[model samples]
Target: MIVAACVKLVDLRPGVDRLTGAVTPSTTLGCSAADRAAVELALQLADSWSAESVVVCCGPDRADPVLREFAAAGVDRLVRIDATGAPDSADVAGLLATTLAGLGADVVVCGDHSLDRGSGSVPAFVAGALGAAQALGLVEVGTEGPGTLRATRRLDGGRRERLVVDAPSVVSVEGSVAELRRASLAATLRAGDVPVEVVAAPGLVVPPTVTTRPWVPPTRVQPPPQGTAALERVVELTGAMVERTPPRTVELPPDRAAALIVEQLRAWGYLEAVPSEPATDG
Candidate 1:
């Protein structure tokens, strides 16, 4: 069995300059937290199945370090798709799908979303391009049979659902469940010597899809007061304004409070309504 782990190199300490709204570079690059989880999961699965693990990435030359780190960590192969500038998510997905297909990967693992963009769309796009079953936000993965992949997916409201997918499937791992392992000194030294196979992107035109929108400050309007209103304004300025009443609080029984919480949840569409039983004539 062969497994491919798709990952992205992201800013290690990502943040925005509050005053400028511009991304503040931490001057470091590494695999994203989500991708690290995906890679860890892939490594674990490969070890369990005695399969080959491949680390794949699509980015510029700056991403070489990340790929090398993964190679040192334990991947059998390291492939890098060198891109010039930041490409669209669709283009990146296309490149990854193409590369994975050429590699003949039985299973593809990736992070549910990229830390930089947080769009959470690339994995699905790759699955669609490959015509493979997709399991998103998976916290656990294993094999049920020779050609079947079983996964536990994290859902909303802290719920989980187990799913079984056939071979040639794409699994997007959740970051919360993936903990990366440190590479040994020997492995690190070996990784430094491993040559990363570089591939050029296909003849797909990547148009500029992202643009910065100008920020506009809000404006407030105040109508001119005259006659009675003007007199009231003058009185207010003279410290004779009426005092406002404080809000009142109410306490309810434990059961009632729980019911109210449930009602609020339902009203806000956070809870689904239970279906009613079918009516029958007796």
Candidate 2:
């Protein structure tokens, strides 16, 4: 049996493409904590069932660093689905379904939600595409010997339901379910040389999305305040008009007056000093 874990390389710090105004993944690539847990779950399943473990990723060549990282953590195979630009959810699901079908994967493990979009709908879409059984939002997973699996899923109001799932199944798990194991130095060194298999994603038409600014109410025009006196007009226009305080005359000596003026200026933020460095004699 072969178990495949689907992972994504999200941008730790995303940058906007100036020309297209689309969000671009940065060089600082890393999988989400939930994806890390999915990989770990796949590895654990492989260990228990003696099944070959595979980690599958979908991204461009620049996303190879994350693939290498997963390899070091010890999956039997690393496959990169060649794709560029941000594919829509349905397109991504189609790509994954096609790849998994080609691999003859008996089990597919994935994180419940992606860091980019928290829709958590890809696993369901993949299951639909492949005509496979799905157990999503699982908090616990275990084999039921041979072709069956045991899963406990989270429900609304902090409730969990246990399920018995048949094989050729896709399951999405939460990050808190498992932690990935550490890789030894030798394994890390060897992972760098383990050639990653590249597969081209099947061409799928991503549905176009329409984006528009929020609707705002138009500005309301009102007639000028009907009042004869300026103060009455001001009162009508503002609803509440504050009278300015009259300036007071003060009697003080020149030095005291100067000091008081300087203090007032400082309080009003008009006496800020520039940072300086000691001059060096050259």
Local accuracy by lDDT, each model: 0.83, 0.85
TM-score of predicted structure 2: 0.70
Instruction: Tell me the tens digit of each residue's lDDT in model 1 across 1-282.
Output: 888999987777856655556664565777667899889888887887788999888877777877888888888899989885568888889999999999998899998888777777889999999999999888887787654788899989999999998879888987876787899999998888888899899786667635444475766685553437877877665646658555555589999988887987886777997577999999
In terms of lDDT, the poorest run of 10 residues in model 2 is: 205-214
Cα lDDT for residue 140, model 2? Answer: 89
- Stretches off by above 4 angstroms in model 2 are 16-25, 205-282
Lowest summed lDDT over 10 consecutive residues: which window, candidate 1?
A: 208-217
Residue-wise C-alpha lDDT for candidate 2, range 74-149, written one tens digit per residue: 8999888898767888888888888999998999999998888767898999999989999999998888885578
Instruction: State model 2's lDDT.
Output: 0.85
User: What TM-score against the true fold does each predicted structure earn?
Assistant: 0.71, 0.70
Residue 30: error of model 1 in Å? 1.8
